[model samples]
Target: MELRQMRYFVGVAEELHFGRAAERLYISTPTLSQQIKQLEREVGTTLLIRHSRGVELTPAGQVFLARARETIQAAGLALKDTRRAAGLDEPVLRLGLLNGVPGWLPAALEQLAADRYPSSTVTLAAGTTVDQVRMLSSGEIDLGLVRTPLTLPVATTSEHLADEELGVLLAATHPLAERTELTLDDLAGLELIWIQRAAAPEFYDDALKRLGDQIRLSDISMSHSQLHSALRVRRGAISLGSCRAATPDVVWRPITGRPLVAKYAAIWRTDSHNPVLRSMTVSPGLTAVRQQVVAD
Candidate 1:
């Protein structure tokens, strides 16, 4: 019956999973379940049916979802109108950029934010995914370009932005360097350059799902410059990253069949209704940003 309950229900309904919805809403799974049960009792009908895989909405739940969304939208508009009548100034925009974020994504988002929030000053912070998640939870930043698989704060949610395709980077003289595309089998006996795991633990964990056990996974602290230096001087040294603009003595090749990807997302507090977040997330600019990233 409460707005919070409606929002919780909507999150669950959209995701069709209690645990995921709980994560997105920044609430415990038990709390979410209790709220939904209370909501169902008030409505005198079952809203969601739990299953082993996840949950599914009933006929009444579907109808309730439509009204709940409308109510939430109207409530947001009423709040905005009241704030405008009171002559409150726009809040400053605090944005966090993940470490090693693709340059073009931040550039496009920053430009869109400037256009939408001209009266509000914009600030940018750079940090790893772990750091950005902490900042988001503490309300230090209003929005962030962060890696996926992050357990966002209770008040926050995330939308996937794009992924960076990671390929093999090797010296031109390496045995596999001449191939247009390489597979996992081609990676044997070569050293892989990797960032420190402490920097982005969740991202590394998510990436582990795709990287099969066939290749030898090494733990090493290698910077981009160090990797480049090693690739130039050592024939067997290699790394996984964006292959754009390789040096004359170095080459990049795609992973055959499937690619290794570094996923990204835009994290923001769900209740903020931030105008700049609204502008890019719902407007055509989101697609434009994706296209720009692809073009780059």
Candidate 2:
């Protein structure tokens, strides 16, 4: 009926001798004997045949003993996970981030990761959100910095950390490149050059869905390479990317009406059994990161 009762039952079942089982449990022989009798009564079946030489399990006892062992093991694991989440007893935190996490976030992230995990090591990574998501799902990493509109399944818990606007990258000589702002309709029929699914699947997929069927999709050679080949070849070619990705070689223009904003989120798989990973905290750091972006 209770975990302690199952534990005592298992101990006595394994030892067979009342004195030995009590010694193993650090309880008196009489206490162990009484508890075993109580357990048998509670189960409505006789658990053991007691004799002066030794104890032997009844048919009911054997079946219940096996199940009791499993229940105790499962309960122990659940307690371990709970303590780990509370940072009472946990391993290191494996953290992953997008390649271009804002500069202002490092100190805050370091503080939180370090303060809460003095005995733990926090490993940080820089990569596409899709790669981080894959790592989290595969148990390669515990946490990820993701950019949304994410289409990943509901099994992942996503916390909105910041908003990164999607901008059009163009050469300085291009018509709208010099303009600080451009509207959604401004890009209606333009020859667009963008990263293919290989460059970054989630980003590319979300971009395609937002841009719709009216625009043509072109391919870039490298899956990991950030360079957009089409944008490089032609002066008028354009690509959609995060504002944080804006570089010196390319000027960014706002997408007038749409003002597309990509949300940066902390994502972790909900189904993960890793206790240390499930204990991660994503609080004030997210707010600080968002504020930094706003202040900038």
Best by TM-score: 1
Residue pairs with backbone overlap in model 1: 26-154
Model 1: per-residue lDDT, tens digit, 1-296? Answer: 78999999999999999999999999999999999999999999998989999999999999999999888867865776588578763656678977777777888777777776666566788787878887777556778888777777687777777887888888888888879999877786567766666767777766655666666565566644467776676667777667763788888888876678888888887776556666656656566667666776
In model 1, which range of ten residues has the least summed lDDT?
Answer: 216-225
Q: After superposition, how far is residue 214 of candidate 1 from its true place, in Å?
A: 2.2
Those runs of model 2 whose alpha carbons end farther than 4 Å from true positions after fitting are: 1-90, 100-108, 151-155, 198-203, 212-214, 221-225, 228-230, 271-279, 282-296
lDDT of the candidates, in the order given? 0.77, 0.70
* Candidate 2 similarity to native, TM-score: 0.57
Best by the lDDT measure: 1
Note the residue pairs that clash in candidate 2. 182-256, 183-256
lDDT of 2 by residue, 1-296 (tens): 79998988888888898889889999999988888889888899999999998899999999999999778867866886788678776566667867666655544555556665556677776677777877777556677777666777668887776666777877767788767898766776776765445435666676667766665554433332444545667766677665655667677777766666666777778776554454444355446545655676
